[model samples]
Target: MTSTHKNGLSPASVETIAGLSAGLISTIIVHPLDIIKTRLQVDTSSHPLLNSSRAVLRDILRNEGPTRFAALYRGLTPNLLGNSAGWALYFLWYREAQDVIRNLRGYNLGTQLTSVDYLAASSASGILSAVLTNPIWVVKTRMLSTSATQTGAYPGMIFGLRAIYKTEGIRGFFHGLTPTLFGVSHGALYFVAYERLKEWRKVSKKDQTLTNLDTIVASSLSKTFAGTLTYPHQLVRARLQTYDPGATKRVKGPGLVPLIQQIWRNEGVIGFYKGLFPNLLRVVPSTCVTFLVYENTRWALPRMFGNADDDPSNRTTVARKGERAL
Candidate 1:
């Protein structure tokens, strides 16, 4: 029998809900950091000090006038939509893929999955979610990279999409897709570190499941590790997706290889990590909130809605075991 939450939702549905909720809440809390990160990534100023998070944030607030505070959340609508949908799809696909692999392997209930399983499942899920949601990301990058004072700045997500469609056609929405796909390694690394960290904590503490604090710490560390190593791809992707408000033709930018070469030639290796500081600041807490909310929501939903006994962790043998399956 297919296991369902007490609320009559499948486990996958519950996970999707959790992911959506997590992304929505976390994005709202940390959007200002996102704006800073995006601006820093696209900034090509020769002076390193000019590109610092503090400088960028101060510039926005001091110069943007009435829109200063609001500017911190410039692309909020698309960002919210993209993150909520992306995380939802990622968790759903990841959990389903893990189940498929487990069933194929004939693993018994509550069997611990290997790191290889996590890599495969996370990679597949990341690629699928990244592909499906690239358009929203393109729109978000446009809104964030464009100053509020810019002539062709989009007023909202709908307007942004319509503008891109009219001006750049459907192809505009998939900008930077190549680097985005390559960035899947980031997610794979994150999940592997996350699961392994939880396992290590459980072993050290002699506990079967981790506390909420443990989950937060694990996610923060995992995000740091994955984000630091794979951050260059994000910089490249952001640059490729940057909007040119003055352009009438297709959004023109260097291809993946040439762009990387350009950054290398002009800015050196540090250019690829332009926003690492603010990104880590944003992503670490954002990841903590996401995993914490996801795990807690999954735990609470069934009990709050109907069945108090539907433990999400034990749903399948290959279900994430330690750290409350966050």
Candidate 2:
């Protein structure tokens, strides 16, 4: 794909658009598994994590059939809205940061930025987006859990927001801030490794077809590595956001450390990795679809939407094939 977007639209801006498109597409595709993963993760039943997912799924499918199956998409609207906006902002900031790095290093427009550049950009954007969208996630988790367990029914995103705000106040939306900050590393590691691997493939003259198996493998493996490394934080975050009526009686006062200790003391080290199997089953393909879509969209959008060549600045600011312009 050409870097014409980088030339006129600002690479990061176009990147944001691509990220939004990709996020919506992937969320729609994998949300069922996401809801299933959450149910399995937050489950306190004695059944093993993997088995609990199976049992829950089997019970739901057998008893409720079409009704429960329909309920599986409980929080999908907020999930899609949150994810699309979050990803778009993530890519926008990251690519804009990349542009800044290129300027600092005296690199031109189309230059292949280093992994370190990607790391910085991805980490900053990931954390910022996570913090801003944490409320949506909180609402999403609650809605999904409620619908899955047939507990409370949230009329809509607005109703869910009002309920949480009324019950928990502003702080309610930030239920998992600490663990989310930690999960920033997941985005950092994944983007760095993924971009580096792509660079490696290109350097080795292996930019095969657009949606090759290698691209999928690279995206999936990078996500898996990051997810494994940061899996504990995810568990804690889920548990933190998940409200149980009796939680106050079980754990110490409100804090991440207390929650961490509670899990460790109760479930031991294994507590931190609940639902890894099901999560991976969803995540690997979810990431693969996201990256694949992002790449394709970024590649296609320049041709589809831009008229940079007709712009006076673009005509005057020509640079080499792999070099960028100011």
Q: Any runs in candidate 1 off by more than 4 Å, and if so which?
A: 1-7, 49-51, 315-326
Encode model 1's per-residue lDDT on 174-279: one tens digit a residue. 9999999999999999999988888888777743557888788889999999999999999999999997786666646788899999999999988888988889
The residue ranges of model 2 lying beyond 4 angstroms of the native Cα positions read 1-13, 63-66, 108-111, 148-151, 206-211, 245-253, 308-326
Q: lDDT for model 1, on a 0 to 1 scale? A: 0.84
In model 1, the Cα lDDT at residue 235 comes to: 94
Work out candidate 1's RMSD over C-alphas. 3.1
Model 2 TM-score relative to the real fold: 0.84
Q: Per-residue alpha-carbon lDDT of model 2 for 1-326, expressed as tens digits?
A: 22454335545555787799889988998887787777766765445777777876776566542486476677898899988998898977776676678788998766777778888888888988999999998888877666544445565788878877877789888888889999999999998888777656556654322234556878988989988888888777877787653232223235898878887887887778887888888889889888767766565555456644423122112122332211
lDDT of each: 0.84, 0.73
In candidate 1, what residue range of length 10 has the lowest lDDT sum? Answer: 314-323
With a 3 Å backbone cut-off (N, CA, C), the pairs that clash in candidate 1 are 110-317
Backbone clash total for model 2 is 4
State every prediction's TM-score relative to the real structure. Answer: 0.93, 0.84
